[model samples]
Target chain A: MTQRKYTKEKKVGEGTYAVVYLGKTEKSRQIAIKEIKTGLFKDGLDMSAIREVKYLQELRHENVIELIDVFSNDGNLNLVLEFLPADLEVLIKDQSIIFKPGDIKSWLLMTLRGIHHCHRNFIIHRDLKPNNLLISPDGYLKIADFGLARSLGNANEDLSSNVVTRWYRSPELLFGAKHYDTAVDIWSIGIIFAELMLRTPYLPGQDDINQLDVTFRALGTPTEANWPNVTALPLYNAINVYAPPSRQELRNRFSAATEKALDLLIAMTVLDPSKRCNSTQALMDDFFTESPPPTRPENLPSKNTNKKQKTE
Target chain B: MEKTSSLSISRPYYSPKELSYLHSKTIADSKKVIYNQRKHQVYQYLFQIIKVLKLPLKVLNTSMIYYQKFYLFNIFEEEFEDFSNIEKSMELDPFNVSLASLFLACKNEDCIKKLRDILLVANKIKDNQIEENFIELQRKIILGLEFKLLQILQFNFNNQISFSTDSLVLQFCKKINLNYKYSLFCWLVNFDLMLTPIGLTLPPHCIALAIIIISLNFKPNDLKTRELSSGVNENILDSLNPKDFKCPEKLVNEGILYILDFYIHQYNLSILNNYLPQINEDLNKEQIFKFMNLKSKFNNLRTLNEHSIDGNLLKQDESLSLFDYSISSKGTSRFINKRKRLLEEID
Candidate 1:
């Protein structure tokens, strides 16, 4: 707000459109200040930004970052966002801890709920990864960075397959499918789930081509045998048509997860959108319904998801 | 048509201030500053007003959300003043001022207080007087925005589609002690959409998912074989709030929270200066409305789609045509259920 003074603190980060800064309001509210630099991207602000602003503004759950204020001066748009203590990816890389299943469930539950709400509102969180998921010191998982969410209900006339970050990308998206529903999100959730369980990415393909190889090798590539209409996809013709991967390989890769967790994991990451569990169904699975149920936040063993395989 | 609207190639994205300013005067002049203090104050006032309104918290919450979503497209409509909508030849853009839309939502949905009573409280709405034609002007606004609301939200489309799946949804609601239509429909729209993802627009699979999960939660005994049906598997039962349909509690809260969030952003101060015109005239009117909204008025959407509804509607048609006909379609009933429920959010 104009009346409230904003004192820029330190340079936090930078992006395509804006320079990120840490600023404090006159009322002592610490905020993440993003100064939108003009004339950089010929396209100016994208609808993704509007969606982020609107969603952050409307979303007031505890696990969500609160939008403080919006300021425009000298043609620069200043977005004041609630300061999160730290991002999960940062914590995962920086902190050395092994998170138990219970802790994993808490983060997963909170993250899915936040994402599920967005989908219901016809909004898709195009980009979801450990970095975008902010964790408070209290162990609450608040989804931040809506810079890529597109309201699903909006008639985005032209179909574009451009969505999600590479590692977390869904097979349908990778196979060049547009008009994909909320299932793309479920796929991301699957990857996030994998990260939580294995302490590293299950499928880490380098490029789009390598990504497919890693995906099929882990989960196996789709064929007329398993995933019907696989060839109909735009990119289906481009990729090598290989037999499905053995389920035993998947079992071996994710060696530590309980059977119930594996059942839910396989269900969500299924190649078929129809077969894949949407966010709602994923929440109800047996993994979440285990004997002791998912672990409470306080009972979490650790937060690191990048574990190095130990040599015998 | 007003000159405020322009065709949208791509409007500048989130500066936060892109729509923060709200002037005490014209909407165009006042909405200049992105994050001006006055703009923030207006939103604060709106939040306060909605908070104070003694209506069903759910209904108020969703109605405010509808109002907020209406703003998201205002920029689009404002850009294309001439856009024609099939749903309403009136206009496809939302007006800067909602005193009228709010009045209609309250009149039809909330009906909490009389026009005079609401007007007395909302006096600061625009610093104008109660003209004799104010009621009639409000009528035009009711028509204009209502048409836009129907088009943008495509509540009519929702109503049409629900004719098929809602019965399946209703069956599930009955198992959970939410037998009443109010509760059933709320379960269908608010709670169901969140509690049950996967666009029901797809196929029986979406409905199948809902049934299997609801069956598991509602009457796990009835499911012939429920090892793991897509998303709702054995582990899901752990998170279940057994005491009043755990799914309902989680989803209802989600729906209410979303509506609450809608209000916080819907009352944009940017609207204070750049007032979107309330109505549209033909000839030079843009092609925005094009076919959808306008066609709905004259042509027969008839509630049939990829799936044949002849037999389905024929069965329910003769019995409840009286109730269903007054409204656009069964899907309208569903949306009215949602809008009515969400509007009650303030309570």
Candidate 2:
């Protein structure tokens, strides 16, 4: 019922599939309205919109973005989402916003918690990147854009490996492993975790092959001994032969991170998807429960104080 | 505002009796029989489309859920007649809506069929020849029905019965060491339930339990004895026995009756199989063409880019026109506010 209660303020962004508009409810609550471009998709609303609506409806958590309402006006499908001002990518790229290890921990904690909730609900956020991790005006991190999210119910079902962005994709996905689990998301979360710490994408590969090279270089090149059934993967033979990195090399790369943080990172970014630390395990790690506590949402760095950006 | 948790009472939580009432209330007295007959015929057509598309049971299950929800939402058409300007052209074409619902379900369930393929399939099924409106119908489904469908669902599209059937089978058959044949029977009964109003009405768990009890062919005394002899807690037995339980008992009993009715109806499958011709014969082609012509009149849509004027005007009325049917009945009023409260409580 957005026609009466919510007023579209301005166009914030536009894409081929959808348009993002800033809107205000009658109570003056700011909301983001994502209008699905009707004529663009021959089929009804795109699968992404369906996935986002379905999962977001079921998943109600602080760290997850809220789907306010869904409506059709004229011919366009509008998704009234909780207005999240600045995403993590914006804040992380902003040089002026300085972040401590605690800040990094806080962001990661929220990310893991969101991912944990999703995983517990049997959902896998296939696309987990900084851009998808939106920030509220109060500095809380919310997981958004469930477009690529899906439930991992049928373990044997061969999913299309062409999911998740190349840079953040897991090694198994890179090698064209069709049947995978939550480890794919865990790898992405680990990369974002590293990005929050380093203030730059850990593996910013230009392409799929390059992504494999960088991934193997960062975490030692996976061998038959380390990752069983590695050679049997679809694209495993296409990989560039490179010497595996040593543990010392990984430590040197993130020298600023504490030992516990490094341990959690190593567990999360393990070469084998099966061995990777899941969201729940990552939350239980010493990085969260021990020395450095995650920063409070209010105290965490905020990109903008625009009153409309304040999320309830 | 009412707590969002209470809004779970809205859907996937409705009792069979409640849903029966909903169906009676939504469908007009004159059109009820025709509507019911048309819905089953359309479901048969959806099955045909599913076979051609080679979609899994999940997509069929999802598509059926969407179809039922569309009719449930027809309830609002009467209450909110003031906003009928745009919705007037949105007539209930069960055939077209069924195809559209399946098209959306394929994507939502991750089957990912191309619109062209879906149109080709629909063309093959409907007329054995392609029609000009097939593409337009697809677009209408995406633009018209999909939005209304989601609004009716409040975006909660998880048809838990399918998933729950699998889990219940595993729990009852493997974990509790229940009858394996009975579990399979229960699983089969679930698909039949989807075709009935009971599918949309009863909770998944209640249906699963009812199926088990019905399939077990156990007398009331035997069920108790099985529980005692098997050393398994009487959880299932208690749930199955209507007297001991609360709200769920009515759901279970209603589910059993529905399943039994469905079994008796299976003999009429031949009659259902021949419904496609009857549907074609019954369709008001002139009325459909008139609605299609009406559709083109509203094609000059207000783009999201042009928003300044609509902004100020919307503030005058608190009731939203964007999707009042969705908002007032099953929108952010419950789900979003509860989430906001949850987030605030999370430190």
Candidate 3:
């Protein structure tokens, strides 16, 4: 056969910067190239575009998205990224995808390690969602999209979270905290974990207010009583009177979860930044330490449930 | 604009043709004044140490300019730096700034490169060389040379042709010179400052030529006009191959004028630092009066923000840790006084 060329692999999704194309590289390697249309700014691929390119270029870890190369021709900037066959959201939506104890544990561990790489480099992956977390065919997770990620030190000295999607967003960021460190990523991980296990968004809120409302209703409310010293956050005053979450309530909702998993969740979902379980510490948690090495995706611990199958 | 929220596409490394105009009609001619032998020794010693360091040629050119700017701020220093705050200004961000703001003309330009590798290449210089004492002196140098550097960078880039001569220099050598400051300047210009816009963001080659022309110590013929001397001429034109340039006549003249004028202007201008109290002060006053008449708009560079050394002092502490804690603190008052003197309002 003559050497094949890309025949419009489906437009998987559109992003703020580029229209993502699922294509194959010249070496016949399957890759995703994000073709960005620069606006009047003649801003060649944007800062975030270059940032993501640089960030991925430098960080070559098991859990992070590996950048192949960036393509720039004439005025257009194209980012040739690694092609991930499926993302966590796809797996989560696939009713056939079973959440065995080992499977869940492996994902959690992989996610933690991926996040750990970011924190070690003093980077904060501002946006972390299951969709952005692509799952390789072999089932390893790659944390993608670092357009907003930044190193800790800035000349301004303003530090507080400027991140978190409203739904999974931490309260600290909601108040417009100026200095955000790795804690913001940890908060997103907690939401991702909840999304994975619960099969639905743990807190599905529309806008910032809606997200806060969903979080409050699910976990009661956050106050200095629960999230100690939260009142001192850069934009802490923006939040209304805090109401502490009932630990009893989380225990009731996640009854299907294992003790270790719940413990990890609680550690990650700490109200205070100091109390949050960092990626390194979370990696050392009992979930991974006691696991049967997560049943290696090929041997999915063989779930045999027959009753009431979820319609895909 | 097709806004890419996932990516922070802020600004491009190159300047557009429209923005390449020099705001000032006439630049200062510092040719008559003589460079103080004391400061010139620093340049001579700066080269000596640069030779020892063995930096890449491209880096050498960029670094020379950075060394000059650093000297502009710390005019009295003759030695290398120990502390640095260049990074704090966000000038260290390789992803954001131009790879070209790094080098110099061929006689001055020792190297050439695409210059991307330099930004990511860190920790090449050993730590012992970066002492606290060294940083303090460097900080003074950066502070002293701030405006002098700005005039070279901002106003002079009114005309040009090439895209990135600085990066072209960096592509050639790891260390272009042995002078510690020159080596560091090469690294900063070709590698560091060229990588970030926070501290010193320079335009591309065309703009670079423009800036060099405008900052000329002697009266320069405007090259934007058809008949201009600041461009490539045929005598030098015959020696170089025409394969590289499409318009060799234009490029050669522009290129040669850039080199001849830049070093000549830069070297002659270096002498003027000693006579700040004489001809320069009068010219400076005249420039101030002329600039003051322009309506207070976006281009008014002499804002309160520019006047305050507090911000610059704080920014300088990041990479060029050359501030004397006692001096930087007490120096703020003196710095303000000095700043006022340099930026004195015309009565």
Candidate 4:
């Protein structure tokens, strides 16, 4: 049942495993055709492709990118994904685009909602950076690229701690804890939240060791008292100790954020994995309901409008 | 606009009658016996491969399911007919198809192993002299079949509901407070059922619940194991409800009758047969007789209504047709998991 349902108009991007093409369906609906390069290596199909297909096929949420369809052509696997032209990272990087307090709140709410859906299904989006949180044409934020995502299986199963980008990596993952949970994704979202406020990466460590120092120096070193058995982690070692940030220091750090926002951020970025607030708790936090309501999706600042105005 | 004839929506499941109809079309009468014989041998071969790889039981369970599921849509020995070269055909042998299934299963279950490493272990198990050229050809064939296996699955990676049947069986046993011996008995039944088409017919949860009910009723007092002291909990069986496990009564009944049928017919070849004694002392008969008795008792149970499924519907099911691998290469074959979405698209 192979028909020309979609037409690949142009190549948009290329990764190690797939070449993404900007395409359109027969109904003129925009789609991204991810043509996976099969049989390239001795492994045949890539693990990331399998993970993407396995998890994305099961998940269906407004805040998550839709896997429109999956088909193959000329021995190459093509994943038809909903085309998302913009992402949170691009918006955060554009210095001219001033982010309103409501805009930041809206993006955070959408991100949390998407993640809550995944966590409810027992899936952990291991790579939940701003880059993967794509924006649709109508300004909806979607969680995309589930290359490192996996479902929470048996309790005794060991997970690889060497996941999530170094800057957004959680404390448990940084210290090499294999028995972590969805708390790791919460930590990444917390960092992304901080980046939205600062308009830059919250933690810009050069390497793994620097990442640990940068993370602890910003939030305070995790000790046996705060995070029990943290010292027992595989990568835990002697490091420079630092005091936890006081309320005044945090307030000064994120001057524009409300008290509730700071409280939610602190809850999400807890040093201990068990103590970290999950997606549901984070969504239920008073920050979302307090003060100015989040900006409507259509009214949210977009890069496309700015580009068009500059061209005119 | 061009007609989207190549968009094949994924229908991951079918009724028992539908499955039989598919098999009748795919497997010729002359090749049916040979197909079953090879399937059994391949099951053992995959078990060994999984054992050597140190993969979990879910991986083996999923691989066997994929191996069986592949033959339902594709011809049993069509690969040999396509490949002209004898060496190339050898690469696409039944063992290689099983390897490809195991390979995809490992990835799907998230217990991944390198294809080369798996091939190495498989070669060692088969005692094939792994020449460099032969290994390359085998790798190519396995890789090719891996893609075909994905299409056979219709890109529906989530085959089982939440977990595979073996783990679900153990989980259900623990939930029902069954003793270790009884739980082991259920697990062994699951192991035996993995080799049958019960997985294709019923969901994992239903099959798991059915196994628990069977174990409780079977009362395997003479089950061979190190921890045989813990006797069966007869009260738990009375308290057991299918709703507690999220399994419909009809589906669980179907699973029960199907499992009883499998054991009645193929008890001697089953793994459970090895552990139990030749004669059941309580009933003063063989284990097959116990299964037969269970079958007689459960004969009145309600199962899935296949009567509503007309013969023409089964005959016209495009999903059950022999999957044309070249269709995707020619155009687009869209895979959607939900039947509702397919209907919406049709409208």
lDDT per residue for candidate 2 within A94-180, as digits (tens), equals 889899888899999999999899999999889988988888878889998888888885654568899998889998999888899
Candidate 4 lDDT over A228-252, as tens digits, reads 9989999999777999999999999
Per-residue lDDT tens digits for candidate 2, residues B1-347, read 63212121224544433454456656778777777777678778888888877777667777777787677646423222555543343344566567667877777777788867887887788775576674664555445665566556655567543364435544554544555344444555566655666557666666666666655542112211122333334565544454332325556666655555555445235332222222222233422232233234323423122234343443452222222443333433333323354455345
Measured on C-alpha atoms, candidate 1 has an lDDT of: 0.50
Individual DockQ of the candidates? 0.01, 0.20, 0.01, 0.58
Q: Is candidate 1 or candidate 4 better by DockQ?
A: 4
State candidate 1's TM-score. Answer: 0.48
lDDT of 1 by residue, B25-131 (tens): 12344343432333244334444444556533233323443454344444322334334543332233233234433443443231334444544445445455767
What clash count does candidate 1 reach?
Answer: 59
Estimate, for each residue in B145-179, the C-alpha lDDT of model 3 and write its tens digit: 32222223321221121234554333322221122
Q: Can you give the lDDT of residue A120 in candidate 3?
A: 88
* Model 2 bad stretches (over 4 Å): A1-4, A23-28, A71-75, A302-312, B1-10, B13-22, B25-40, B73-93, B131-143, B159-172, B178-180, B218-247, B264-347
Model 4's interface RMSD? 2.4
Model 4 score (lDDT): 0.85
Error of 3 at A139 (Å): 1.5
Q: Per-residue lDDT for B84-179 in model 4, tens only?
A: 686667654778888998999888888888888898999999899999887887887888888888888877888653588888898888887888
* i-RMSD of all predictions: 20.0, 7.1, 23.8, 2.4
* Ranking 1 against 3 by lDDT, winner: 1
User: What value does the lDDT take at residue B98 in candidate 1?
Assistant: 42
In Å, what is the interface RMSD of model 1? Answer: 20.0
The candidate maximizing lDDT is 4
